[model samples]
Target chain A: MFNTRSMSKLLVVASKDQLDGIVRELYRHHVFHIEDFVETEEEGYEGVKIGMPLPQASAVSTELLRIRAIVSAFGVARSDVVPERKESVSALSARIDAELPQIEAEVSDLVDRRNHLESAIRECETKIAELEPFVPVQVDLSLLRGYEQFSVLAGHIPAKVELPVPAEMYFSGDVSGNLLIAIVPNERLNEAEQFLFEAGFQSMPVPGEEGLAKDRIAWYTQEISRLRAEMEEVDEQVNARKEKHQTFLVACDELLTAEAERAEAPLRFATTDTTFVAEGWVPSENVEALTAALRSVTNGTAYIAEQDFDPVNDNVPIEFDNPDFSKPTEMLMDVYSRPQYTELDPTLLIAIVFPIFFGFILGDVGYGLVLLAMSLGLRRIITGGAGEKLLKVLRNASVSSIIFGVLYSEFLGFALPWEPIGINRHLNIGAEAHGHGPDIVLMLVVSAWAGILHITLGRLIHMRNARRMYKPGKHRNKVVFGQAGWILVMWGILFALWSMFELPLMPSFTGLSPIVAGMNIVTLLGAVMLIVGIVAIGQENSLELLELPTVMSHTLSYARLAAVGISSVAIAMVVNYIAIGMMIEPAMQDLSLMGVIFIIAGIIVFLLGHTLNTALGLLGGGLHSIRLHYVEFFTKFYLGRGKKYDPFGMIRKFTED
Target chain B: MAVETMSVEVAEASARGLVAIGAGLAVGMAGLATAIAQYGIGTAAVGATAENKDIFGLVLVLTVIPETIVIFGLVVALLLLF
Candidate 1:
């Protein structure tokens, strides 16, 4: 659990006669992370080219494609609905090849019929819409057309439109104020159409078939309903078939994918006419197990060897090993980079500190309880959906917040009437009470102390790492002295500042004078440490002296923990004061119509205000707490570029392994 | 002449006013500086993290590192105001 799993390189050589058995055995073990073979001119490593998959690979691939098309058509991909039974791959493929074509034909037949019905319905609707506008006019539709000398412009015009028509043109209007027809000499057709177009008129499309508008409307309605009824029956059939085959199809997909992956594995192997070489990494502990499995499966035809280790740059894949409780913090490594196999894994440290910072910022019992409930309620969905890593982190953070919240006696910033078990930050209640500002300063001091411990621990770890990385015989001291000096300076200045500010809490210097004049004696100690630190580091580069101010500011930065908490609580208090104190209390004291409105408004304010604070608390608290670790703590020691381990076998989502 | 006519209580109140202004300036300017720094860092951090998500944790830390300036300002403001 202290570091990444130990890894070693394994070389597997197999004769052509036993290659399949060895490959299958490796798949079962799922240990090897295969490296792609690059053809080299070195002795015994040269090859014609990478070997191709067995002759059966092409046939399996084609069958797999057809199954995919059917599966895509059905579109059922839920991982939860796994098959209750397991069947052999050959049997599954045969069944798929035999049954799928008939099913595909059936489904396509229904689809084609549905498409035809839909188009017919659309055509009928278009016909009905065109003829409806002409229904208000009583004249027979054929009489409106087929004129040689006369032109008929029949359309809908505005209800009260005045068109400038010459004496030669004739206009007809219907009582429904929709149908309009203008008749004029063929020579005047352009003039009349232009006039009608200007007067907001739209021409209706004339239908070719001879039929009454009423009859056509009735016919179209009947046609549409008939198509819809047929469509419903087709949908039912398709759904029934889908429900019956979904599980089987998912199993087929998994089998096909597994087979395809295995068949393609030969692409990474360097092969000659009769033998193959497989080079990959497996954990040192699993090397014996892999060797035994491969030998047994291939009847001693497959041989194995261990390559010599390279300490400086072996490029082994990393796999972290942590206790169950700290596993969620492994997710943080993904957000950051995984530690190199040679270096330490900091998941345990992150698991401990991240939640402490979270709870400190969001300390309120009521909010914590709500968050706890939300995270717990979503446990199942989170485990199945995005992941349980986030849920676990949140669970720890919420638990911490609850502990801190009860200590602070805050239930959404209302300041509970009872005394706190420890200390309540918002304790000002009477005329002689200390105000909010001083209380905030006290919180800042607490944050600063936490920062001091966090930074000191970081420096200790950094110094240790640097020492470990130093060459064995080299006397070069690049780390320990510098970190020690900085730690001394930080602690020293903290005491000095506390004394200068006249704060009640100040760390005492062991067996030394507390203060001389206004300057604390610790300040004198701090100056000495700073100068000595610079001298030790000056040999490498004196420019680091400038970083003293930056480092001091970094320590001050931890006060944000207190600053964030104060703002969060301040908002909650404002909400409670305005919503309850100003509105609800007044409404309760005297009942009236306006009072009832005030009570309603007060309740809304209370709910919305508290909910908003809860959201802000989760977002700010979670991210900032993470930031403290990443920026303030992790920067001290960790450097990451470790490759992750990828096993050979796929997790079977559809069938039993 | 205005200072000579001022009462002791009035003079003390004015001194409190000036201190409050100084505290406000300390925090305000500091906050502005933090915001400016974060604007550039936040954008670059986001862009770099998008290319490789593994840098997300480190990018987040760098993005918020400048926030310390505001806290320092707040400390100064509190000291002055109190």
Candidate 2:
């Protein structure tokens, strides 16, 4: 498909009493993209104001919030469980009113108990760890604290220190550091503190409890185990509740969400005292069905009519009309932006061209096979999301890579059994290997030719889009002519080069007799076209003439296809040379224990090197290929910042109407 | 006479070595230029991506737009070597 789906503007008018029926019908049809009404001092809007939400909106929102809380408290994620069956809205509403509060109470009670138990366990654990250093000192905790006449210093010190004043001291340490406890008379506390400070002492808090350190630790550990067991019991009770009510809670959530949306739909409509008006865009083909649905619901009282809209003036929402196979490439289009409603959609073209560029850049059988397997494997693991779509794109690119690999006659940088059916990428300049080494010049030229054709196609698309988008006028003609000029200049350059040089895979016109001075027919034609094209471009915008060099540079840019591929091939070859020629071969001849170890090490090197190369190949190939499209190709035509189509409806998963 | 011929051979070998060095510099300097350009673009792209992740594809394309310079260098290097 070349364009987005055609949209028709719909205006619906009904009495306020019929608003509910109209809204329900429209939502069910799921074809209308609502355009909200904002009050302004515009003609025909004098009596109308923004509509208010239905009376049930607040109640529906409250219920939805409660359901979400239950879902989160149970850690029930949408992806965590599959929807078993759809529940009717009536059944879900009944369950919500009857059972939600009781379940809420039970869950909150269990969650609060679990939280209290967890904090208590943390407190006990902290106490045990704090008292752990004191265990080796063989002191009672009561002796360290609650002394009326004696002051104590207990903590770690850099080294053992003798108390300056008379005191009882206990010290234990290893080469790293020491823990010390000093008990002195209150009068001599200053002296003990000064000495400890000089010894780099870091103080520890003394526990207020009364018991030996080891005994306290033992008691705390026993308490912790008991609390942990209780915690487990609480968790099991919660799990049982989750198992029983997860499906219901999920269904209620779905039902309430849809209800909330419906209840709030009035806020987007324009309302007067007695009537309401709704305006939205619907696909042109669905207008009849929508009108029928609305009329049936309103008992022929509601007025539904299609309004005339100009695509140039109206901000119509764009929904891509690409075929199913090209739908995934819409993700690529989204990365830029959606195409404007009247503009051409390039999804199909990208689907066909993007992978070809990727394949050309990463043409190697081994890497292609590995990437294909990885994408397929990852697809099975992650399904039904953007990640799966990306994997699908990668799978297509990998298939292309394999096809190119066959043409290039390469398998992980090694020569295949047959000679290259396409351009050879390997370079063996002087050696008579593989008939002839890679034609580097030919590869670059081919890449450039690919760029020329791709850009030319882009310019052609731009010209067509311009003709369709603009009315017949001088301005429209200028835009179209500018695009045509760009195409002509590119081809003219190609023709001039062909005439001047004996390029590979190009028609040689240099052998033709010169018509005047030294210029042949091809060169003369190329010159005339270049002058005319430049003039045409200048007429459109003289400033654009400064960008003439870009045509040449962009053509050269596609040479990255060959250049990056060659680099990858070179890395693979070096990897193989080191792993096999330098290490494995020598080890094979030696045939000893060290030789076996070397062989194993070589294999590791081989695998690691290839793995790293494969990852690089994917990154480089995909980025460079897409870059050619985004920067060089798309810059010629694409202007995408269109509004996305978001019809007001729900695609129910866990519940049904 | 023997010494003269040996000196000429030495000159040819040095010339070949010099050409190799030239090719290496062409690619290496262009790569450095690309890196310098990417340093700023890449950091800004990362900051933008942190704010909103949907623009990652666009920023990725922007970040690599400068890499064409290195590819140009590679083309030059290939011409020199082969």
DockQ of 1: 0.52
DockQ-based CAPRI category assigned to the predicted complex of candidate 1 = medium
Q: Show where candidate 2 strays beyond 4 Å.
A: A156-180, A184-203, A218-240, A428-435, A515-517, B1-13
What lDDT is reached at residue A299 by model 2?
91
Interface RMSDs of all predictions? 2.1, 1.4
Model 1, span A127-172: residue lDDT tens: 8888776665555567667879877676777754454654232244
**Model 2 residue A596 lDDT?**
97
The candidate scoring highest on TM-score is 2
Q: How many Å off is the CA of A610 in candidate 1?
A: 0.9
Q: lDDT (0-100) at residue A131 of candidate 1?
A: 75
lDDT of 2: 0.88
Query: What C-alpha lDDT do the candidate models reach, one value each?
Result: 0.76, 0.88
Every candidate's TM-score, chain A alone: 0.83, 0.92
Model 1 earns a TM-score of 0.82
Q: Estimate, for each residue in A46-98, the C-alpha lDDT of model 2 and write its tens digit.
A: 98999988889999898888889889888877665678888887888788889
